[model samples]
Target: MTTTRMPRSGSLPAVRRAALVLLAGAGVALSPLPAQAAAGGGGPSSAAVAAAPAAAAASSAAQTVVSTALAQKGKPYVWAGAGPNSYDCSGLTQRAFAAAGVKLPHSSRMQSKMGAPVSRNALRPGDLVFFYNPVSHVGIYIGNGQMVHAPRAGDVVKVSSFDRMPGFHSARRLA
Candidate 1:
């Protein structure tokens, strides 16, 4: 049987889609510098060039995570919900990245410690943004300085900005 894959436009934030379209239009490739190239002795090796696609795939996975999180917007925020419907702070992040094939703990504090530390200025789309002194809240960044997350009980999953989040602490990249 032939299957059709349709673009889920509603799930993608406009900034993400636009950036992706621009990247696709530009035909950009990121070729990392190999030891030889770093020494100024030769051009990037085939391995370095080959790895670019993997990096791109990784980025795509991150985008998928953000889209998944965005799709969960408006879902009810439960204390420990981690599912197709409702979600908690870390649960939302957990389920989002899980869709991208990355495993994450359910606790925001635990998830915060899993990925490399990302400085506020260096954050990119797909980085996990954490909040509170003890890392009590987590959100999936979706570019344009915004993130999608489960705020609290009686509230739904929503988009928030770093400047507005209470006690903004740190961020991490899982993909």
Candidate 2:
């Protein structure tokens, strides 16, 4: 009688990288292990290695949205505005979210009413922060404790650190 063994999926290298990327973000740092070091003679399978790039691309895209919004700092503010000319507080946020492929309502009050509430400390790059007694103002939280918004009707869009803004009520993550 001849004896034969089936290769287990666990033995594949590609499966390992895919699992790692899924477990962590694209930022997962991996040290190259020699093929001989692995249980199988072959290094991690091609699939795992291929998965890394996709995860990295996703993370990079997310970062780009925040950066793009920040880059628009100093642009003029136009009431009831959106896009290349100028922006109101909500218009700035709407444009920023649109850049990241998320759509939001035109009014700050409308926007403040959407999305899950996030704590100030837990805020992420694309989150929206609301302000004022009646929630008349809104800004896009760009991570690192700062946000981008149109300060007033006469002012231009700008980036303000969290401490610089007054009366922050809550943050909402849109993307």
Please name the candidate that would achieve the greatest lDDT relative to the true structure. Answer: 1
* lDDT per residue as tens, model 1, 1-175: 2122223556555554444344334332211111110011121224522332211123665766766776776678899999767789998887777665455778999888875688998877788898888879998776655677888999888776556677889988655
> What TM-score does structure 1 among the candidates reach?
0.67
Residue-level lDDT tens digits of model 2 in 1-175 = 2122222446535644453343234222222222121011121223432332211113332344455555566667788877656678888776665554344678998888666678888776767799987899998776556666788877777666666789887777544
Show model 1 residue runs off by greater than 4 Å: 1-58
What Cα-based lDDT does every candidate model obtain? 0.65, 0.59
Candidates in order, TM-scores: namely: 0.67, 0.63
Candidate with top TM-score is 1
Provide the global lDDT of candidate 1 against the true structure: 0.65
List pairs with backbone clashes in candidate 1.
none
C-alpha RMSD of each candidate structure in angstroms:
17.7, 17.8
